[model samples]
Target: MTAADTFETILEMRARAVEDLLGSLLDERILPGEIARPARLLQAMRHGVLNGGKRLRPFLVVESAGLFGADQDAALRVAAALECVHCYSLIHDDLPAMDDDDLRRGQPTVHKAYDEATAILAGDSLLTLAFDILADEATAIAADRRAALVLALARAAGAGGMAGGQALDLDAERTQPDEAGIITLQAMKTGALIRFACEAGAIVAGAPAADRERLAEFGSAIGLAFQLADDLLDLTSDTTTLGKTAGKDVAAGKATLVQLHGPDWTRRQLDGLVLQARELLKPYGAAASTLKLAANFVATRRK
Candidate 1:
């Protein structure tokens, strides 16, 4: 296959793998009659997770694993774990006290779909289940490796990473943040998990220190680029195309790159970030094509 074709194929396969794993987890772990009488609760959890989304976090985990010669089977579990954490964050972020949005991935938010209490529990369950999946002996990675992966994921999802960034974002809403402040907020809130995705893949594959560092850089650059693109999309795209409430950032008074820099300038910045990420992967040779394409895709994605 041509390089572009190969990258497209990899993205398709990765998307399918993520959807399958997420569906299975929802069916077996979330909905299997463990809860009492609230079918809507399980449905809300599944809806929040299984709805059509890019699944970029899991894709990063799988692609980075390929860089380090890890088999797909070995990487699948880690990918699933990453998605769990991501979904849980989204669920909580959509709560009444948080973003208070009614839509996610073109569907009703978990709280809107079910109730506030159920949504809270569902988010909590997904977060804990992420660690459970990592610790599962049957599909579990080596103990030391699992420990490292768990640590990486926890740190990314916790106060030092996504949550901390979110807190910063909330604080930034009431006031106009400078460019540097906006970047710092985005880096912590969104970039941390994206960085963790790549790092976790490398860790699962037992990558050397140098390769791991390179992948981490690649992830960080792409993560920031992804947020910039999101900011741009919020300004440019409509709700029908975006599958959620567009222009919500402006309504929420969120300080985004697009707010600091105009759309034209923000687009240029995204291009620079994507180019830098690709350069970081040059040493990986042909094996890095997928990463390069993924970076481009993230920068150019419309929704």
Candidate 2:
């Protein structure tokens, strides 16, 4: 099969695994130290998370860890935890106070599926559940490794990372940020978790710090590419293809690199970023082929 097809197969398999794991994780099984899993809240969380998407962050976690020969099962658990955090962000992002979206992954958003209050609690629950999974013994990783994962994830998902980026995005609507400001905001908002997803594999396997740094750099490059591509799609693609609202960025007056530099320039930047990401993965040789494709995928994804 062609490389793209191969990558699709791998990605599909991993996405399915992550999806099933997330379902089990969200199930109403009263684990230790948990009081009660409210039915409505659990349903909201499931609706928010189980709805289909690429599951790219979790895929990165698993694939990055694979480079270092990390345990597959352990990697899956870590991937699930990261997916939880990602879904939680989507849940909160769709709130009336935030993006105020009615659709997500081509389905009703959590708030629309349930109630606003339930959606808020569901997001909170998913965010907290991510840490719990990372810290729990079920992950079957070393204590130090687990601790490292937890800390890294917290930093990635917290104010200095994704949340901070969202705040900047909200502010951008009011005051247009300069080029540098836009870059910084994108790095923290979209790039942070992608960076963590790549580096977490090294942490999972206890790989050398240098390797971790290398993967992180690769992630940073592709992370920028991902957002650039997304911006391009926002301007070009329609809602039917994008699953989410298309042109929402422009409608909301959000500042984006695509808006500033134009589509031609953004495409060139994506090419450069993909090349940089590929170069970073050269040390792993053929084993890095999937990751290289992933970089290309991030740059060229239609949705």
Q: How far is candidate 1 from the true structure (C-alpha RMSD, Å)?
A: 2.8
Tens digits of lDDT, candidate 2, 31-97:
9988998898999999988987788999999999999999999999999999999999999999999
Q: Estimate, for each residue in 143-183, the C-alpha lDDT of model 1 and write its tens digit.
A: 88888888888988899889998898888867677888887
User: Which lDDT values do the candidates have, in the order given?
Assistant: 0.84, 0.92
After superposition, the stretches of candidate 1 with alpha carbons farther than 4 Å from their true spots are 1-9, 29-43
Task: Give me candidate 2's TM-score against the actual structure.
Answer: 0.97
Clashing pairs in 1: none
Candidate 2: 10-residue stretch with minimal lDDT: 99-108
How many steric overlaps are in each model, in order?
Answer: 0, 0
